[model samples]
Target: LFQKESHIPLPPKKDYDKVRAAIEDALDKDDYDDGSYGPVLVRLAWHASGSYDKASNTGGSNGATMRFDPERKFGANAGLEVARDLLEPIKKKFDWITYADLWTLAGAVAIEAMGGPTIPWRPGRSDKLENEGCPPDGRLPDGDKGAPHLRDIFYRMGFNDQEIVALSGAHALGRCHADRSGWINPWTNAPTTFSNAYFTELRDNKWTKKKWSGPPQYEDPTGTLMMLPTDMVLIWDKKFKPYVMKYAQDEESFFKDFAAAFSRLLELGVPFDEPGKPAPA
Candidate 1:
């Protein structure tokens, strides 16, 4: 129920903080398919926000339009309802926050819970009408594609080479589902923890093209771990490989850069802070 205020009043920022803490608590308790809720929460935020197009400004984290049937029905959004459902209690408790802000904050919470850096977040997004919902499918990157494809997809979202590498560090948390993306196995051994194992595995292990009937993906020589084609192309391609090697060589540096880039990814289109406000540390 909407409360009719005498005049437009700003919601307490503490309410957003409370919702964030509650979501963190929920993530701590949930041990889902990928071990922690961290991955799904990350995926939820990605799928929810990855729809942005700087050219048209049709979609972004702004509307939280994934709530509508048309947007929810997209194939890439499969299994994301699990994430939305997990955060429902938090939303109910913090009735003042919009679904857009709540979902992105849940991502920040998940990242922090998994031992990642704080994702600077701010509030002020509202849910849009269903008529303003639904982005065309395939906004998110495909695992089947190579570096060129990765560049094409993410560059369209306004990310550069460094940001793409940093954001893909999310592979450190979740596994590919055969049912969802036709890919399997977490890219790193400790899929739930927010370590730099993804870069480590990429550098240390020997990868071979997977010989399977599903989507095109790579396997480590031991044949246990997996890497998507797009992931491997980071090494195969000359342009992106340098950053990948840098992250692979230094864990601390990787974490620091990843935290900044991931936080920016979460804040993609939502305007927060004044024009001259200092950026998040």
Candidate 2:
């Protein structure tokens, strides 16, 4: 007889909800970034899942590979340690839940709490042995590049043009730390909340080149905000522009698509176990 495919099962439904509430409670604090841990948590989930290379099926959130060496040291993952460490206490509390599931659930919870879309996430990812399945680096998108690079990076993960545009809307939440991405800018004034403000601002505002020494980022005439070249491509590329315009004009559409893409992101790899074995335990 042929052997069955291996996979971790999902946790019990109630247990999954409890883990989510715990993550939200731990992050809903006064002392965290943007008055909440929402943004970093989103980044944590993204970095974990974004390593996916669909052709090989080797990288993604399912392995929680960022917890190990080399993968953790990747330039793209530079500041994510803060996010990982912040969740340590919660991990200690719910020791049974895999880091893979924890990080993704945290992302979903953060989105909902920050007034973003309801990201439909399930908890079934199991942590791999240390150094067992860390993917090759350079999988994440570069902040300085334009449309072609964005397409190269995202399309490798199997995202279509619309999904890529929708995912980029996540820029609405966090600021780029100069120490990390070298482009210091927040996509929106309310970097704490999630909204279609990024698409709207790009559509309505005149983004002038900021006289900055670091890199060629665009600043609005208001002189209070900025956009990276990567952000600009959303409007410049004919393929991506339609989605940006659609999102800018319709927040409902952005929310719906973003939620679908995000859920898909967290489940990039791993075979689900029979019955409910993949649910959070």
Candidate 3:
């Protein structure tokens, strides 16, 4: 997709490639979270695109509205401000790239750099003024709810049962921080890369209710991993269970579907001059 402003001129292809690489270079090294910034970067992209409203088409990554309040202040968006701040320098260097496109590209690139699918992406999203395009609360999924809730949330954004399963595969990469989402620990042994381990673990493990003071969640027998009630419901419910098994057994299948769903996600509400092209290599 072409940048909205013809006069401003899109960053030359080589320069755009440099900006993508620079996002990889800037990962935070602190131990509080994973040593890599991939997870949060993915979250930044997901949160940006996740806010799209199919009915009104108000949200999605087009406006980069999450930088402002309500969205920045929302409960589901906790810990995301860091992701926004992390991308600031990249924005400065390639001042032409909009936050909507930058955050989403950061996410897609982080997934690839951290050993995940190469999400097809492009730059077309334009920046919105402060508080100009913030989506209302409750667009993102909640960890405490079940399958019906997942359906309601994702379906609102035009995802099918299959795409919803594919997108949740992202959990394989990130951990829940006590200070942030109130849930603690990564879902997989390797929390730095994208894999179908989340699907396999959910399908294979004997998960019992986590005996803790925090919100209801599940822990595996070995105590090396955890799953949200929301995570487990995928296996428990018949409608969502088959896809769980499929992703667990086939990594390529997961990657392909995830790319399509996520790419479609980034484009929601975006009025691209050209509709269906993948990101530049």
Candidate number with greatest TM-score: 3
* lDDT measured at residue 186 in model 1 versus the true structure, 0 to 100: 80
lDDT of 3 by residue, 19-107 (tens): 88899888757764778888999988998899887987788888888888878999999999888888998888887778888899999
lDDT of 1 by residue, 46-149 (tens): 88878877777667787898999878988788888889999998888877778998898888788888888777666666788898757787787777777887
Which segments of model 3 are wrong by more than 4 Å?
1-14, 28-32, 278-281
Scanning candidate 2 in windows of ten residues, the lowest lDDT window is 1-10
Candidate 2 stretches with Cα past 4 Å from truth are 1-14, 274-281
lDDT of 2: 0.87
Would you list the clashing residue pairs of candidate 1? none
Q: Write the residue-wise lDDT of candidate 2 on 110-133 in tens digits.
A: 999999888877767888998486
Clash totals, every prediction: 0, 9, 0
Each model's Cα RMSD? 3.9, 6.0, 4.6
lDDT of 2 at 277: 44
Q: TM-score ranking from best to worst?
A: 3, 2, 1
RMSD of 2: 6.0
> Looking at model 2, how many pairs of residues clash?
9
